[model samples]
Target: MSTVFWAIVVLGALIFVHELGHFLVARMMGVRVLVFSLGFGPRIAGWSRGAGETEYRLSLIPLGGYVKMLGENEEEDEEKDQSGHPVVVADAPDSFANQGVWSRIAIVFAGPAFNFLFALMVLVMAFMLGVGELLPVVGSVSRGMPAEQAGLRVGDRVVAINEQPVTRWEVLSQTIKRSEGVPLRFTVERPEGPILLTIQPRVQEMTNIFGETVRTWLVGIGPGSGTEFVTYGFFSALVKGVEHAWRMTDMIVTGVWKIITRSIPADQIGGPLMIAEMAGKTAEQGASSMLFFMALISINLGILNLLPIPVLDGGHLLFFLIEAVKGSPLSEQVRLQANRAGMFLLIVLMAWAMKNDLTRIFSDG
Candidate 1:
């Protein structure tokens, strides 16, 4: 029950922020927003400021949300009344379709932009409040692995990898992963003083978060069972936050590329159930962990929405770009067909992810 609650809260907050971005930007562009909803399906609870104004709603479904704008679904046409006679509506000037191409582009892009910025802000707060991280000390080396073969021992503190300094296990792991089986020089601090060891990372297949098998470089060294709380000054935290967000973005992009190349299976994709379980587990770990997880999810959502696929923010931007180039929008028929295809693809993907989630649950049970 707690897990369900946290999952809803986390997802709700992210979705609200995303929709808020669109709502604010659309308003700025003089678009009349018809509805601001926090979820899909029938409205469960809501309030309206006045007749014909935006209706704020909390819907039945908590998995997703949307902001509906006036004329968002209508192509520019002669205004008509219920009798099909030409007439002007009171807020026709505020129609989204009547806005300039650039304005529409900005409104569409704002959702993803806000998600990324929210991640940065959350990261900064987490850093300022202090978060625990594993130190760069070797706890154990797996037998017959690259680390052991290179004579790495317990208590040896890794100082650098190939002349690049590493003070944390996270940085060390990233460095190893990027080595791509290349030989590396490890500078370590031992009781006998500093020592250099040459090691070549082994290419190994590992299961990723989505349960998809992916190949990565590994040195078979594990961090000691010790953690250190790290806190940064205000300015340092801000800088670190930006760096953290960028690193996460790069990692996500690389993961997507690997998936596209079929280096990982599509079954690795997960849906809401997986997210709920993760949210629960992270919440149990404490406030810092929960906040960090939120930041990570925000970044993922931002990047996912920016993929150049129809029915997404990136697709809208693509349409705007083409319109700018051709001096007109695509025909209504083409746009409708493209959107239908995109929606179909999305539904199929969601069903597959749900299947994976259910499989995991049943197998675990």
Candidate 2:
């Protein structure tokens, strides 16, 4: 329940900000927005200002919200459809479609931009408070394992993996994971003296929570006092925040590439259920922790929306780029078809995620 509360709050806040970006910009440009809705479906509670706009609020739906401008859709009502053009509505306010191309572009891009800004803010907060970092230490070396066979001891602290100096546990883990089953030389400081150990991990096949089997290398040992915490001030935090954003963006691109390359199975995808579970766990940590998780998720949302698939911001951007090149927007019929195809793909992905979630819950670890 705590998780659900935090998740909803974060989701609602980010979504409200996203829609508000559009609403505020549209209003600033003198666009006559007929409706400004916070959420979709029937209006649960709402009030309309006589001169400004009709704001119809709605019941709680965690999906998303939108701002509707005058004559946004091509199919206008007969009475309202003064001009019978399929693309542009004649009575459309001169703000949205009427403004210069650049202004129009800014409004469309602002929503995602704000999301990234929000994430940066939260990350800055996290870094300022101090992030936990783990040191690389060998706690318990598995018997008959690579480390044991290579004569590594319990108190040996790993100083470097090959030529890579290890400061944090995460760096060590990533280096090892990337190496797969390859043998690597670890320089460790033992009680007696500094020693080098050649450890080769065995690839272990195991089922994930989603029931999908993945091959990962296993070195049987527990990480002992593996991490140390460090805090930063404003300047450092901002730098770290930017660095974190870059790393996450890289990961997202890599994940996408893996999916395209078929290296990552589509069945491993997750949806709302996985998000909720993550939210719950993060909430248990505290507000700051939950906020941190929320920021990361927001970044993912912002980037994912910009992918060049249909019905997404990226899809729209791609079309805009093409329009800029070809001298006009794609025809409505062609755009609509593309949207339908995107929707179909999105639904299938969601269903697969839900299935994976269920499998994980029922399975014994």
Candidate 3:
């Protein structure tokens, strides 16, 4: 019950943030927003100041949301005035379709842009709240593994790997994973003295966060119980937050590309259930953990929304770009067909993700 609650809260807040971006930008550009909804489907609750005002409301489905602007989906060819010419509903002074191409692009881009901004905000707060990280000391070395075979033992503090100084367990683990079975020189620190050990990593099959079996290089060493809590001041936190967001953005982009290239298995794609589970687990850990998870998910939302598939923010931007190049909006027929195809693709993808989520749940059960 708590899992579902946290998931809804997290997803609902993020969706509101995303749609707020569109609503604010559209209004700024002088477009008339008809509705500002926190979710899709039938409305659950809502209020508006008066007629001609935006209708702000909550909806049935908490999975996603939208902001609907006047003339956003106007059919130019379907309506006609007294004359034989087409009655362009989108050409109204305060309609979204009447805006310049660049304005439209900005309006569309704001949804995803706000998502990244929200992530950065939460990450900065998390950093200010102090983050716990593991040191590079080995807690245990697996028997018959590369670390054990290479004379690496428990309580050994890894100071460097391949001449690169590593102060954190994360860096050490990532370096080893990316070593690709290469021989690594590790400098370890002990109470008596420091010693250098040459170790070779081996490929191992592991289940990743997405429940995909992946082949990765490993030295079979785990981090010790030594943990450090680092807190940043406001300015430092801001800087670190930007850096963290940038790194995560790059990593996510690379991951998406890898999935596209089949470097990552498609079955690894997860849905709302996975998110709910993670949210619950993180919330149980602590506030800071939950904040970090929310930030990560926010960034993921920002990045995924930018993919150039039709029906997404990026798809709208793509259409604007094409309009800018062609000096006109796309033909209604073409746009309609592309949008239908995009919707179909999204439905299929959602089903696939849900299937993966159920499979993981049952397997674990």
Better of 1 and 2 by TM-score: 1
Clashes of each: 1, 5, 0
lDDT of 3 at 5: 93
What is the Å distance of residue 120 in model 3 from its true position?
1.4
The digit string of per-residue lDDT tens for model 2 on 1-365 reads: 77677667777888877777777776777766666666667767777777445565654555777776664553642223437544455345543556555555566677778788888888888878776676788778778877788787887788898977988777777777788688998988877788888888877687754345888777666678755667889999999899887777677667767777787777667677778888889888765577688787878778777778887667767877777788787898999999999999878877888998888777834
| Model 2 stretches with alpha carbons more than 4 Å out | 27-30, 54-56, 74-93, 142-152, 158-167, 171-222
Score each candidate by Cα lDDT: 0.89, 0.73, 0.90
Model 1 Cα lDDT, one tens digit per residue, 86-115? 754434788887888899999999999999
| TM-score versus the correct structure, for each prediction | 0.84, 0.76, 0.83
Where model 1 places Cα greater than 4 Å from the true spot, the runs are 75-91, 142-152, 158-166, 171-220
Report how far off residue 104 is in candidate 3 (Å): 0.1
In model 3, residue pairs whose N, Cα or C atoms come closer than 3 Å (at least 3 residues apart or on different chains), thus clashing, are: none
Better of 2 and 3 by lDDT: 3
Worst 10 residues of 1 by lDDT: 73-82
Model 3: residues with Cα > 4 Å off, grouped in runs? 75-88, 142-152, 158-166, 171-189, 193-220
